[model samples]
Target: MTHSLDPAALDQLFLQARTFNKFTAEPVGDDLLRQLYDLYKWGPTSMNTQPGRVVFVRTEEGKQKLKPALMPNNVDKTMAAPVVAIVALDTAFYEHMPTQFPANPAARDLFASNAGLSTDTATRNSSLQGAYLIMAARALGLAAGPMSGFNPTMVNEAFFPDGRWKANFLINLGWGDPSGNRPRGPRLAFEDGVVLA
Candidate 1:
């Protein structure tokens, strides 16, 4: 059996982590970005269908392309962030299922034949992978601000012109500026959110 994480570890990963709206001038290097993916990729997905694909927007030109897609409130902070990760889902992720889930070699055929099933699986698994990215970033001492206020169509047209991948959400990554944070909001208690069956 595995032991629970220590309090400090817990705090780093969840207890004290905040969705930062602003970041410091410090840069999040490419090396750190690679490491972040290396850690987050280990997270499980349904049938190991890791549908999440990330595009790190770090260049000025990239930010410019992303600007119009963002909501007005998200523009300034996102532009100022060291890196903005475009978390996306591959529409045809099942193509890789043969290798990823070799034991179920027929999984690819199953997904390919059912568009609705494939779409549902891609969206759900990619969203879970996005959460894993957040936790991994926090564990690595970086702050993440995941946002859903953007125009997904705009983002897809701008970044994923190939049409194989579609945007799910965006996450701004950097060293957080605590002064920019709002007061911590309330969370649903276990009793309020959970049900025993």
Candidate 2:
């Protein structure tokens, strides 16, 4: 029988979690990065289309490469963070469907025949995977600050020059410094944003 997560677990993953703007000096090791991917990859996606691709920018050179792409408000904090993850989507994600979703090999052809459908699928599912990355990091006692204040063209030129992958957003990962966080922002009530059929 499955059980719901305890309150503390829920808080850690969602409720009490905050988008950190600053982090401590601790380094996010490569091992932890691999572990983070392992945890989040299990999250469900349409047709199991795991289209998310991540580039962990931990080196100073990598940070410099990312600098030109960031908006003014996002640059300093991103540079200070231990690791900045460039979450992207693979445009040709359907190529892997034959392996990832072998139960329905025809699904690959269905996506390939329609450009609009493939793009929509990649964008939606990859965004979901990026959210899962944040939750996975939080579950592992790390803080995540996801941002979209960057020039996608610049990011794509700097990181994904081959053109198979496209930038979706960025996530700065580390041990957060509470002193630098702004007061928590209020969220919309369920009734305000949800609709029941």
| lDDT on C-alpha atoms for all candidate structures | 0.96, 0.96
Backbone clashes for every candidate come to: 0, 0
TM-score of 1: 0.98
The positional error of residue 130 in candidate 1, measured at the CA in angstroms, is 0.3
Query: What does candidate 2's lDDT look like per residue over 1-197, in tens digits?
Result: 39999999999998999999999999999999999999999999999989899999999999999999999999999999999999999999999999999999799999999999999999999999999999999999999999999999999999999999999999999999988899999999999999999
lDDT of 1 at 63: 99
Candidate 1 weakest ten by summed lDDT: 1-10
For candidate 2, the TM-score is 0.98
Give the total clashing residue pairs for model 2. Answer: 0
For residues 94-152, what per-residue lDDT tens digits would candidate 1 score against the true structure?
Answer: 99999999999799999999999999999999999999999999999999999999999
List ranges where model 1 is wrong by over 4 Å. none
